[model samples]
Target: PAEVPAGPYDALLEAAASALDANDFDGAVQAYKNVLSDDPGNPEAKLGLAQAELLGRVQGMDPQAVRKEAADNPGEVNAQLAAADLDLVGGHVEDAFGRLVEAVRRTAGDDRDAARLRLLELFEVIGPEDPRVTAARTSLARVLF
Candidate 1:
């Protein structure tokens, strides 16, 4: 029996996971991107990259402030998106999905489209196999078309 050595991408994947664990979102993103450059279909690298990118956008944001802004300005798409991001990071998966679904229900035209796009991005972050994502997809479809 012959033993196979680990591929070079293995180190990059490890670095990406380590960076994610350290909350070094930028580092994780770069590492994941490096992995994808070599193996574009790698699910773990894609998921890691998506999560890092989402976390990077919301990094250093105050959850309470974002939530208050969303509450105070229900019509503001950016505020709602920010609040949803915070909720996702905080483990409030249902809250995150609900916020975006509500936004989709209330908005129209480009605003509605924007909310829909953000919801899809959240789906990517949460992964398609997650039950929460499955439920959210059904809710989104009901609100959408």
Candidate 2:
């Protein structure tokens, strides 16, 4: 059998996957971006990049602190966002979605927009096909308009 040559992005793809597995979100994001620079619209790289970016934002955050801040100040958009991120990372997907949705409902103008944008990012992190995203999207739309 003849040996096949490796694709240019193969190593980078592997590196990105490894980085993601190790929770090295910055490395994964960079590697995924490198792969994307070569092969635009690559699904794996796109998804990996989204995941990495989401994880990177919450990298050094303390979940308990975030939750407490949100609890202490429900109207604070940043605190709510951090709490939602913690919920998502902790596998409380519905809780994360609900938090953002409530934020969207309670806030106005730029604060509402910020919460909505964060919710969309969480949708990406959860993948478009997720039922939670679908439900949240509907709820978000209701709140927006």
Candidate 3:
């Protein structure tokens, strides 16, 4: 177990870590829950929980979960981007749309450009013939470059 928290915390963290590595989402979710129950202020616990709920990848891994790690402290854009990837891979077209929509709404620069590029990639994944792709493209055109 975790000697730091000195109890269920270590075990909880361990369980969540193992589950996350194996992509056993439900197990990670439950383990993270236990970590939070013992130490809501623990950064690892918070990050682990968010990671468990996060649906997609970012920066070669999971951004939704990473975003949870910093909690607006930093790298939130990466997290958003990760979420967009997740949505695309998971076949959650609307979700991918939403993630990019929010990203495009940012300060209107690199982040927006990155999001637009990612949205375009998703369109390719789903195929340009998809209606959602049309709508996503139209939305991107309206809100982004």
Candidate 4:
């Protein structure tokens, strides 16, 4: 990656991104939270927080904390993705679908791809003709086909 302007907490953010890339998600989350506490409106910080929270949820932990973050900071793609995934994990398929849809509305990024893949898998689980399956199919087709 080309060099970019240093963020407010360059050292901590670098540490967090490195930890996240290394899959030391717990440490990454703490580091991200540290930056967020001081710079709540930072997009990079918001993205880190969202991704870290998602990673925690994927590891069978909580994700509710990020829901409000996603709602408040709509630019955080990772949080929206994580929120959608967490909703699915919690058996709230409809809620998860809504989150993914909201994600699509918010960011024109790879998060939509992730959401589409998850929606496809979830559709399989929910079975065809279920409202969730239908919605997911429609949304997936909108982007993928």
Candidate 5:
């Protein structure tokens, strides 16, 4: 992918990052969307939007409850998904990736697709260049194939 040049959107992206730092996920999401509207293929904007959306989704969640649910219901795909989100937010990147990859290994049809998509979204949030993401990609492909 070609790099998005340093342009007016730089300030907007900075503001979006500030919003994320401040836990203002809605503001960050909107800011990212605004940038995407103008530069549809901007990688930074895409990453910011994914992070904002994930933060928003997990913001109200109780970590303990989510973890318990996931642990108790290993076959429950949604529970796994929620727990994976919380794991990523809590900086357990490996745990998040492993959980979803396991989910993909054990599930089929829409459930497998959901877990796979969530894992991909997390890849965007973490940046595709991260070694962990690369490892997870390999793991995911192993399960998928």
Candidate 6:
């Protein structure tokens, strides 16, 4: 199929990016959702909304505490997930992926699935083309199998 040119929603994408840049997570999420409502499969809007929502989840967290909790509870899925989110938002992309991959390795059933799903979501936030995400995907595949 021929690639469709950018249309009217480019403005909404720009607005979402601007809101994300300014730390207005709610605004960013809303703008991205507006674009998604019009273009349901819009990749940029999906990525932006995922990032905005992830940041919103961890916005009020104390990083030091989160990290300590994760470090102290390697088998705790929630702790590890929270720390991984914090790591990604803090620009420690590799660390975030590694942590979640390990979480998947150590967990089973629902816990394992949660870790795996969150890792995939982070992949979207980072974009699949990233080398780090590629490496993480390989690592996740290995651990899962």
Candidate 2 Cα misplacement greater than 4 A, ranges? 1-8, 38-40
* Candidate ordering by lDDT (highest first): 5, 6, 1, 2, 4, 3
In model 2, residue pairs whose N, Cα or C atoms come closer than 3 Å (at least 3 residues apart or on different chains), thus clashing, are none
Which residue ranges in model 6 land beyond 4 Å of their true spot?
1-6
Model 4 lDDT per residue over 20-138, tens place? 88878889989988988898766676667656655565775456676787788776777776677777657898887766666665556576666655555445445566876787667
**Candidate 1 off by > 4 Å:** 1-8
For model 2, where is the 10-residue window of minimal lDDT?
41-50
lDDT of 3: 0.68
- Highest lDDT among the candidates is held by which one? 5
What RMSD value applies to candidate 3?
14.9
How far out, in Å, is residue 140 in model 3?
A: 1.0
Task: At residue 36, give the lDDT of candidate 4.
Answer: 82
Question: How does candidate 6 score on lDDT?
Answer: 0.95
Candidate 1, residue 118: Cα displacement in angstroms equals 1.8
Any residue pairs clashing in model 4, and if so which?
A: none
Higher-TM-score candidate among 1 and 4?
1
lDDT of 3 by residue, 67-144 (tens): 464346333566676666666656677887877776777636786777777676566556667888888778777775
**All models, RMSD in angstroms:** 2.2, 2.5, 14.9, 13.2, 3.9, 3.6
Candidate 1, residues 1-145: lDDT per residue as tens digits?
Answer: 8889998688899999999899999999999999999899898898889899888989889888888999999999999999998999899999999999999999999999989998998898889999999999999999888
Off by more than 4 A, model 4 = 1-57, 139-145
TM-score to true structure, per model: 0.86, 0.85, 0.50, 0.48, 0.88, 0.86
In model 5, the Cα lDDT at residue 135 comes to 100
Q: What TM value does model 5 have?
A: 0.88
| Residues 107-139, model 5: lDDT tens digits | 999999999999999999999899999999999
**lDDT (C-alpha, whole model) for all candidates:** 0.92, 0.90, 0.68, 0.70, 0.96, 0.95
Task: Supply candidate 4's per-residue lDDT for 86.
Answer: 70
